[model samples]
Target: MPARRRQQGPRRLEEFAFINLIKRRFGRVPRRVAMGIGDDAAVVRGPSTRDWVVTTDLLAEDVHFSLDTTSFDDLGYKAAAANLSDIAAMGGSPTYLLIALAIPTTLSQSDLSRLYQGLHRACRPHHVALIGGDTSSSRAGLFLTITLIGEIARGRAVLRSGARPGDLLYVSGTLGESQAGLMLLGKALTRGIRRGLAPADRARLIGRHRRPTPRVALGEALASRRLATAMIDLSDGLSGDLAHLCEESRVGALLDRSALPLSPALRRFAALAGSSAESLALQGGEDYELLFTLSPRHEAAVQRLGRQLRVPVTNIGRMMPARFGMKERDRHGSLKDLAVTSYRHFT
Candidate 1:
């Protein structure tokens, strides 16, 4: 999974910094890889013709979700989708999935079945198989950890380190709706009263959060055409994920606020909630959209590719030199530093 780093936090070792510590402590673990530690997935040398892309994600009850807002079916589907998004980021086709679950004894068998149904539904379209997994009883709540394996042509895995200073930054699909959906799911704190929303809008926003689509076809298309210079999925929101990409590639980014994609539902929700859609677009997590960089000259080809795939790819920013850091131009033509307020586990 991509790192969920927040801009502000208490006195503690941050997630990525902790990751770096692990990398240093276990630096001699003797694992051969094409890429490791810092990207969406770890690429390992596999067969003569292809390489393996592997990633894992863990979702804990209360910490990641609650039975109050999420159903068993939606939970299972989102878990699978999250892992699939990782493979999408690596530009690989998912092959197998293994789930390790710590289930509470109180959960009914029917609920468990619904969970598995969700997992199956997500994997079926991509032709991926649930090879094997482990189950154990938990005194606490449910804890699910999924490990996914994927494959790509040898030496063809796209990475976060490939972005250059001049590459254009693009994202597929609209942003911020998932976050809006999550807000609607919970008791939204708007002037200490529940705001009435249209039934259709409510359903749409909730669905976005519950069932995010992994951009498998878009990722494959970009990889096959050699279009993207660097790629990442928007799991941790645009601000943090883009920061991760810039840090890895030693580049910076300048975002055009007007270019940020906003869905109509999100705009309406933002207005009702007394917030801006742009804030939600930048700070919301689990959007699962792909953020990639492309050279300026290939813009036309990518636009055509987006049309062919039926995925809207928007050019929202441009990569810049590292010294410039990450900044954004507001709609009013004012420049300011882009703050990363995405979800972070410890914060």
Candidate 2:
């Protein structure tokens, strides 16, 4: 019998790899491409009336998560959820996705299968089909890049730049839970395997960090009603994400500390960690919630949407003149500089 041929270094990178290689080869990047590598999907000008919204996101081991703390399935679900959140921010419905996975040779086939299963579990409900992708081996850690495609009706896409002064600010759900969950997991891990936690607590915290649900329905609702003047996903903490919306809109905002929502679990965890819950609420990332703005006239409509969606649409504050800059009120009623800080790639 012929001996099995030794495996080559890396199979000629296909699909996205080839596309990216071509782009690199060219000195110029396409301007018509509406979205590129850093988001959930890539948007491009199509022949149709609607503009395609595209974004891509990458989750890597150690940088984004660790295997000790996160399960393979949770990691897969989160990788896709992050991209889907970007689509929701653009006021679009997710249509298709391309997945690129780089795995270490040590990982078993069963582990890889669980990871893919997680991706399918997250995508199928949103009607996002996994159309194409590429796979490669990496010596370092696991890396997943998901490219999502969405569509917005002509002239109907909500951007971060459209908010004007007096526009009310709103968020879809409570904040800080994911951060709290992470803290709980870390504590449990540090205490070693013997200092066990209740199954329920472990499930709750782990689930929060692993399976964040993007507010796709709320985003579509906002688009359909044309109620949101500007919109974005609160992926990188409320403070950071809200700052993004304000910067894009060329306006500033003030969030009442009391008005910021926090889950009970997060509050309890914060107390246990000897940290301020407000700080986590401000800077904690990966909430996967929606932050939007609307005119006063649309307040009732937006509130009605909250009722329908069973999600709280809290009006935390209003947009101010761009020159005023962003600030948030402290419990002592003092105006403190609210700096925009979030997950920055390469920072």
Candidate 3:
């Protein structure tokens, strides 16, 4: 009888492995590109009708994720999602990506294949191409760097500084869901009991953490209709992103705690864990939803956009004079400083 084969096969150089995989995926050079992967630099044509948008993000092992908790596919997906979220926040459509992937000795050829597959899955729907990238061996765990390039019609890219004193603060979809998902995963990890959560609940929370959707469609719609006054993505939590937007616009904001949207899943998780959904919504990061401001006069228009796009648009607050500071209105209609800070590395 033949001996059982090891899960990981014989290894090869990083370049040899990745290049072969990329060539298999590409099959053909795209019409818009004068060059493909394996070049010193990628040369591709830009859309003449739109301005270029570029964003870079990094996902590191230990800092961003642990393989024990999530798969290589999920790491790839979240890394792409995070970069795509940046393009979406600008009211643009992602079109291209350049990756710098560092693989640790722990990863095998199959692992790399699965990781890139997840990245491709994230980009395929958005018509994004993987143009060029560099691969290197890593002494540490996995490190993924993705640079996404996108486009918005000339003069249509939303800036974080466009918000005004009277603009309404809005967020797409519910907050706290992703953070709750992270906490649940952490809980399961800590207790060493994966079955603590109901099967459905486990899937929901972990999926939210693993695969986040970029709001490109809604962002494009908002920009095309001239609806958003200012925009940002919820990478740094509501409190932190709100502070960033206000800082950019030189304005202040008043968030209504009652108006903040929370998902039923998050509510349930919070109840079970004795955690505060409000706190999660405010300070939890990695939501990847768009947060935008719009003029008060366009209230109806914003609602129409939301319905047309079939994405929830919650009006959580309004912009105010910068001197007024960032404040939140409690359910009792009392105002207090939104003193919470979002998560920061090494803080």
Measured by lDDT, the strongest candidate is 3
- Candidate 1 Cα lDDT to native: 0.81
Residue 48 alpha-carbon offset, candidate 2, angstroms? 3.8
Write the residue-wise lDDT of candidate 1 on 176-246 in tens digits.
98988887766645643235567777788888899999999888878877999999999889999999999
Cα lDDT for residue 49, candidate 2: 82
Candidate 1 vs 3: which has more lDDT: 3
TM-score of 1: 0.84
Q: What lDDT score is found at residue 103 in candidate 1?
A: 66
lDDT for each residue of candidate 3 in 152-199, tens digit (9 for 90 to 100): 999999999999998899999888878777777664444533444566
Q: Residue 282: error of model 2 in Å?
A: 0.6
Ranking by TM-score: 3, 1, 2
Cα error, residue 5 of model 3, in Å, equals: 32
**Candidate 2: global Cα-lDDT?**
0.75
Each prediction's TM-score versus the true structure: 0.84, 0.82, 0.91
For model 3, how many clashes? 0
How many residue pairs clash in model 2?
12
Please give the RMSD to the true structure for each candidate, in Å: 11.1, 8.1, 5.6
